[model samples]
Target chain A: MSVLVYTENWDGVFKKLSFELVSYAAKVAEMMETSVTAVSIGDVADDELAKLGNYGAAKVVKVDGNTTLDNQVYTGIIAQLAEAEGAKVVVISHNNTGKALAPRLSVKLKAAVGAGLIALPSSTEPFTVSKKVFSGKAFANVVLKTDVKILTLAQNSFEVIEVGGTATVEASTATAGEAKTTVKDVQKQTGKILLNDAEIVVSGGRGLKSGDNWGIIEELAEVLGAATACSRPVSDEGWRPHEEHTGQTGKIIAPNLYFAAGISGAIQHMAGISSSKCIVAINNDADAPVFESSDYGIVGDALKVLPALTEAIKEAKNK
Target chain B: MKIVVCLGNVPDTTTKVKFGDGTAFDKTGVQWIINPWDELALTRAMELKEDAGNPVSSVTVVTVGGKDAEPTMRKALAIGADDAIRVDTDARDAYAVAGQLAEAIKDKGFDIILTGIESSDYNGSMVGGMLAEMLDVPSVSAVSGLTISGSDVEITRDIDGGKEQVSVATPLVATVQKGIAKEARIAAMRGIMMARKKPLAVVPAAEVETLTDFVSFELPAPKPPCKMVDADNVAELVDLLQNEAKVL
Candidate 1:
């Protein structure tokens, strides 16, 4: 038996998220007294595939020739690999692609699935794992009883371990299934870091007054090298794209650092970001609910405070 | 074409979650509403049915909850579902929930099935995909945009770095998120009165093996009060971030 992990790559290269999954799988394999077999489907380069070994992948199953992710086709491939390898536990990341594929895999393999898992399993016998539930407002320990276990690691939850090793690479014997969907078009977001992958984020809210004044939020984000986000109303008011909205009804993010400028700490907004490690708030109202959750607060008009904060960060970074 | 949009009657977004029987969600005095994501899906279903160009015939909303959930189901009809189905049991996990739904929806020949990406409660994010696998049909996930065209549906799903558009045949499951609709449509007074006459079927939950039992629930630790800083001392905030928070 082996621990099989599905690692995702972008443009023939792997990112921190993939490495983190392999790292998590490696530990699970060790706990189960087995080895880790990592699978890469699509256009990941040879050298890039070798990096999985650094995180304790004992073998790499490379499936070539797919440029884009077709969820059903990929699901068929991963499900077949797990059955052939006798995967005791199948590991994957809890990102968008994983969300689309993991549950399908669980059904095909008859495995119990734990999505958005935050840490290593507390026990391997019952296969108890912890995952984020209730939009990060709380956590629950789940017991997976099926013989084959499947887990999707919550992004950035586990540390990437670099253990010296080399993995045997093999070409996948599984072929693609019949495609049921046709790709119509693609619109890739350019420039800034994607919110789900960002480590730090700077956000604004309705308190910012106008969309044109968003230059201050951007300036601060530039100084901090953070992604820009906003509350639902800010996006609703057309001050920012809906993509930037972070709330219960919007995107739920858990970056290491989150800066909320002029955003009130509403329960909806807080549900999306309460998992953030450090939250800093800047607003004119000293009694705003945001202060109750923020690690630090500056009671001032965001329009004025944002520019000043940006300049201070620039000066501090230069020093 | 008939559409079945699944609804999750969960605690309101702003409700403070408190545990009741150690791990069970405390519902006392907590106002429940259709899950935000599911509400959006219902809104889109209504829009599709209302549009003159679309082939949508009827829209049905289904939920896996007990009798108390009927009020929430009535609200779904008020929001514009043609009918509602209640599974008549509080499911143990997503796996069982999907099985119960499959039992209720199978052989019904619904052309399209809609589910939210994740419920605000539990946030399991699995029912739609598992239901599709059980029914042996194709499915799309994290769908931001969906439109029916010539007996086929074009879907826009979120991928890393950007968006991807794909088209799938009917009798498929599609899990959607925000951007599918501008905002959830509230019930008008007329719609509310009409909902009173709508049919709500409460069927028994199917017996399915439950997976992943929850051992316990723990609320996150609340952060200490924010340290107030002077606007003039912006540099101090930067210093604290770098030295104290160590997140720089």
Candidate 2:
């Protein structure tokens, strides 16, 4: 039996999350005393596929030519690969691809799935895993009673250990089912830190007053190399695009450091960001709910306090 | 065009979360609502149906849960669904839930199926994709915008950092997030009265064995009381963040 990881490839290379998945799969494989294999689909380069070995994958199966990241088709292929390899555990990153594929794969393989998993298996006896639930407000211990276990690791939840090595890439071809939906065009936000892969995030809220004031928020985020997010109200108000919204009904992020400026901590907003390792809230209202969930609360106006904090951090880093 | 909007009944976000026997959720005193995300999907479908010169015919809401889920289903109908289907079963894992839903929707003449990206209760965004696989249809997730013209469906879905436009034929499934509709509609008196007269069918759940078991539930560790820094003491806050929080 093997531990199989679905390593997501972006363009021609594997991103940070892909390596993290392999690193995690390696750990699980060690615990089971088995090897780990990675499955990559679409048009990724060979050297990129080989780099997965640095993280722990022993073998890489590259399905050439498929470009679109269609979850419906990938699910069928992964299910087939898992069966052929006698994979006992399937590891996938809890990103868009995994979110779309894991449950469907579980149904195809008759495997018990733990989605948005936060940590390693607590016990392998009953195959227990811990995952974020209730939009990160709580945790649940889920047991996969079935023989085959499928799990998706929460993004930024695990550390990546790099051990220098290279994996053997094997070319494989399988029928990717016809896509009923066609991607007419792909528009990616370029030249900035991607939110899902960001380690630190600086977010704003309606308290910023208007879209023009977002320049200050952008400056702070740029200094920190952090991705920018906004409260739901700000997004709804069109001060920021809807994609920047982070909350219970929005993107649930778990960066190591989350900075919220001018945002009152609404319960729904907190639900999406409470998983961050350290949270800092800056708001004018001393009674704002964001403070209750933050590690440090600055009872000040974000407009004044954020500029000062950003300049200070820039100085500290330069020193 | 017939569209099926999948429904999930979730505890109101403000409900103090507590686990029963540490195994499952305690249902008492929990006010259930049509999951905010699903409400968005339903409202969007209704708007498209009532759109000027649109070809949409009906919107049907589907859910897999016990009788406790009825009120939430009723709310969907009032919001504008023409009919409803309840696959009567205890809430199970995503796979079983999707299986029951797929079984219920298989023979239905629905050309489009919609679901919230994930349920707020479990936060599993897998059902819609799984349903697509079961029904052998195309699936899209995190759709922020949608438009339907005859058999042509166009959707705008959020990707890693931006959004993409996808066009697909009929017999497609989509798990939608917000931005599809400005707001979920509240059932008016007439809509509420009409909902009571609409068709609400209860069917036995398909026999699919659940895969995952909930061992226990626990709240996350609480944050320490906030360390307040005076509005002007930005320097001190930075020092605390660097030395104490170690996040700088």
Candidate 3:
């Protein structure tokens, strides 16, 4: 049996997410004393296919198609591949696509699943997977008991390693049933990184005073090459787009760094960003709950703190 | 058109989370409420039913929980759901829960099923997808906007770097998130009074094999107090981030 990893490639290029999944799959495969097989549904170039090997994939299968990510079809194809390869463990990312397809695949394969998995199984014997729950405030160690197990790794939780190797690449195709959902339109955001994909995020809140006063926050984010986010109140007040909001009622993100300016950390807001690797808060109130959660705190007007911090970051980058 | 909005009973969002048993969630002194996202989904379903065309014939709410989950179901009925169904059981796992739901609702002939993207407690966002698979239907994930036009069900979902507007027929599932409705609907006094009269069917849960189980839980460690950085020496903050945190 093999460990199968669903490596998502966009426009024939694999991103950090794919490598992470492959890396995770390789480790899980090692635990099970099996080989790793990577699967890509859409068009991925030969050179790009080899990259999966660097992360320990022994074999990579490129399913040639002009893929339009239909969850059912994808599930069918993956399930078929798993059966053909005699896969005992399957790895997928706990993102939008995986969110929709993993369960279907689990049901189809009659395999147990642990979604939002943060770490490798604490015990491979029982196949216990550690995952974040309660909005990252707590951790749950879930055990998958079935012979076949499915795991959707949480984003940014696992590091991508170049474990020096190469994978055998092959081309194949399979027929899945018709697609019921039609993608009518897709509007891509430009000029900024998406919050979900960002490594560093700079956010503002009600303390920013007004929508027009967001120049400092933007300037800092631009200097850091990071995405800009806002609190729920900022979005509700129309200071920022609803898409930029980060809180319990808004987007939940886990970036490498979360920089908050002029925001009092509400419990709801904290729930969204508590998973960030490092957090720095800039607020005039020293006692703001944000300070309690942040690694670094600057008690001052965000309007001034932001610009100075931005200039400093720019200077540091140059040096 | 008929709709079934799956409701998950969770502790109030404001409630401080505590673990009673090692792996089981603590429920003592906690107020149970309909999950926020499910409430919003129900509100949107209510709006669709009350639309001018009245294209929607009925709205039903379903849950996989024990007797403690009934109050939350009643709240959904008060929020305008036509009826409620409780699969009397604990939500042991997403796969088992979905199996129970599919067994209970397969012959019910509901055209559309809506579920929150995830629950606030466990946040296991797998049930909706499993529902679609179990019933052999399509599902839209990360759904931000859901609307009905004639017979078409329009669903807008949040993708990685963009938004995709998709359309699908009924017998589909849409896992809902924020922006499905402007605000959660508040039940009026009359709605509450009538909700008491609404029918709540309690069905026995299917004896499905549990695939996953929680072995243990651990609360996150307390973060150290923030290192104070003077606003005047903002450059020092950068130095600390670089040398100390190594995040720069």
Which candidate should be chosen as best, given TM-score against the real structure? 1
* Candidate 1 local distance difference test against the native: 0.89
Candidate 2 CAPRI grade: medium
lDDT of 3 at A90: 93
The residue-by-residue lDDT of candidate 3 on A186-296, one tens digit each, is 998977788888899999999899999988888888888889999988987888987898987688788989998989998889988988889999999888999989999
Stretches off by above 4 angstroms in model 1 are none
- Model 1 Cα RMSD, 1 decimal: 1.3
> Which has the better DockQ: candidate 2, or candidate 3?
3
Misplaced by over 4 Å in model 2 are none
The alpha-carbon interface RMSD of model 1 comes to: 1.2
lDDT assessment of candidate 3: 0.89
lDDT of each: 0.89, 0.87, 0.89
Question: Any runs in candidate 3 off by more than 4 Å, and if so which?
Answer: none
* Per-residue accuracy of model 2 over A120-220 as CA lDDT, tens digit each: 89988889998877777678998898999998998888889897868999988876678666788889898989877888999999889999999899999
Candidate 1 backbone overlaps, count: 0
Error of 2 at B46 (Å): 0.5
- Residues B103-152, model 3: lDDT tens digits: 88899999889999888888778999998999999888999998887677
Candidate 1 chain B, run of 10 with poorest lDDT: B16-25
